[model samples]
Target: MASYELNAFDRRFQSISLVGAIEQVSPYTLNVGYWLRDPNQLILYPDLVASHPRLDFLWEKTCFEIFIGVQGEDYYREINLSPSQAWQAYQFEEYRYPETMPPQVAYDIELNQLKRTHYGLNVSLDLTEFMLAHKLKWSDLFIGLTAVLETSQAQQFYAMQHSGQNADFHNKRDWLHIF
Candidate 1:
């Protein structure tokens, strides 16, 4: 028989070696991983009973829990749950990849549009792919164009809206120079 230790609170699990040879499943023999107390009744995990939507169907359809004990042993235990609940007790927070900034040169809409329409047809067609496909070196033309456009647009908007009449620079010479 195999032995295992499971810590519920900290969510630690350890598997201990079994004493007997691990029985192989065959047409005539059953290989059960857990032992059950009763032959007629099924034992279920409480969390599984509450959380799983198809628990009843699985319990009814499958011989999930194993019956194991000494020949004369009265004590028995059973493990019952839907396939989803089988690993619920050891659930851990999912790991998320860290955020990365896209290349500065990738922001050019013109190049992006050209690449999308004429070459790759999507954002997935990056410079790397383009280089691989066409044997071209790296290019930042799009990013530079985008930065220039943004700066010019900001300057034009600021000039149009603000007449440079703020109180911080009331002196005519200072105001004229600032404007």
Candidate 2:
């Protein structure tokens, strides 16, 4: 398991701390965890649901995101997991182009836990099948973990590293973890 401290692009939420962790449980399962150390409950979260649904535009609120990309390719996959038990996944040809439809293979959230301060989500995507379809291996994939925290006043972007002048989570250059 690899853990990273996500830095906030906006400096206002200094009282809160966000940390994201990723681990490959098996050949087909991927687990991601997020902890928000908000003593004052500064972040606003949507109500949790018993059943998680695949929804779009999860980034508008408090959402956790993961970007998976092949080491030398422009194509990548993005997963968005929300505290509200809403999630979304997308496959991009390059940058933000061709987001007209969902991924050919749907990424499913197997287990999800939403607590007062910690949110744990386990997602399963067939690695063997993905490699066969994409013509890549585990070593060829890199990851980017990020989040959007919505506070009472505004929304803040968080990531392992922000390479550009703006908080662009889509930027592959900021993705540093190897799958």
What is the C-alpha lDDT profile of model 2 across 1-179, one tens digit per residue? 99999998876668778888878766656667777787877788878766667778788888888888888788788888888877777778789777564443345323333333354444444355556677776788888999888987688899999889999998998988996
Instruction: List TM-score per model, in order.
Output: 0.17, 0.85
Worst 10 contiguous positions by lDDT, candidate 2 = 108-117
On residues 60-83, what C-alpha lDDT tens digit does candidate 1 reach at each position? 322122211112222211222232
Pairs that collide in candidate 2 are none
lDDT of 1 at 138: 24
Q: Which stretches of candidate 1 lie over 4 Å from their true place?
A: 1-58, 87-179
Worst 10 residues of 1 by lDDT: 140-149
Highest-scoring model, lDDT? 2
For candidate 1, the C-alpha RMSD (Å) to the true structure equals 32.7
Which residue pairs collide, candidate 1? Answer: 35-77, 36-77, 37-76, 37-77
Query: Global CA lDDT of candidate 2, please?
Result: 0.75
